[model samples]
Target: MKQKIVIKVNIHCQKCRSKAMEIAAVADGVISVAIEGKEQDQVVVIGDGVDSACLVKRLRKKVGYAYLVTVEEVKPKEEKKEEKKEEKKGEKPTCQPQCHGYPYFVHYETVDEPNPSICSIM
Candidate 1:
């Protein structure tokens, strides 16, 4: 499982910070290591299947005292649905859909004169 592990280490100088970052980056299954927090003593490690306890122990050994601040599973962002309602220009429909079949259809152009001899029943 992918996880984001944050560890707090007592960093004194720039060299210690670099050492801590290097040690965290070298840990197995670590994808990326970054220094964070206000004082820059927190090392954030993001990866899959990274053992938080093992990393803290390794940091304690090399870069002095270290402790795990948080170990949380990283969930992927949900993708948005992109629905396209584009109309085809070359394949335009000849006629629109009718509410009923030909039995209920009326053609206006069939009218010749205002007074016609045709019956309305037809």
Candidate 2:
């Protein structure tokens, strides 16, 4: 059974990211480890029968605070791509939105809390 596990960790620096990757790579049943996210805080591990709890624990002990975010069983990439291609073959390409002498803007009140409003001027 193949599994994809995502873990969120409080990674602060390059060294921390390196250590986190190393720790995740050595864990039992981990086939591959990839660091994701802009902050390099999300660890994506894909393998067969990977132990999520144990991997999280090891990361916490070796590379600071870490927690499991998600675990999903996914089909092989080739199968997924083939399915996507078949689906796309029947779909028409959509055109990009065009702005015709109009101002478009989004306003957010707070950084921590996202309250977005779109404003348009013609």
Candidate 3:
């Protein structure tokens, strides 16, 4: 079955982005890789039978710090729109426990070299 895997990687430059894409491209089942979100921190991968844990490990080793955000089965556009409509009608969107059952991970890193209080989230 096809799945959409969204991962958060610590990308700081064009080189980092290129490395991230390269690592993801050579992954076992990655059909495509793209950067998403306003901050361009989310890497979206679409493929069949993609292993989330292995992909995260590869990214961490080759790209930088990486974390699994979510792994979800791909859905048709009409089904996705229906789910969105249900969300708008007060239904909570169901979350699949793909990140080892964790809701989310908070990655803390220093924003500036001299200041500890200046922090960023990934």
Q: Pick the candidate with the highest lDDT.
A: 1
Can you list the residue pairs that collide in candidate 2?
Answer: none
- Over 1-122, each residue of candidate 3 has an lDDT whose tens digit, in order, gives 78999999999999999899888877766679999978998899999877789889888988888999999998755555445423256745543333445567798986666655644773
**Over 4 Å off, model 2:** 77-122
Predicted candidate 2 versus true structure: per-residue lDDT over 1-122, tens digit per residue: 78999999989989999999998787666678998987779999998877788888878888888889999996875555445433446644543222234687998785663775665762
The local distance difference test score of each candidate is 0.82, 0.80, 0.81
Q: Estimate the TM-score for candidate 1.
A: 0.62
Q: Between prediction 1 and prediction 3, which has the larger lDDT?
A: 1
Candidate 1 deviant stretches above 4 angstroms: 78-122
Q: State the lDDT at 30 in candidate 1.
A: 74
Those runs of model 3 whose alpha carbons end farther than 4 Å from true positions after fitting are: 76-122
Lowest summed-lDDT stretch of 10 residues in model 1?
92-101
- For residues 29-67, could you state the per-residue lDDT of candidate 1 as single tens digits? 677999999998899999987778877887888889899
Provide the global lDDT of candidate 3 against the true structure. Answer: 0.81
User: RMSDs, each prediction?
Assistant: 25.4, 18.4, 18.7
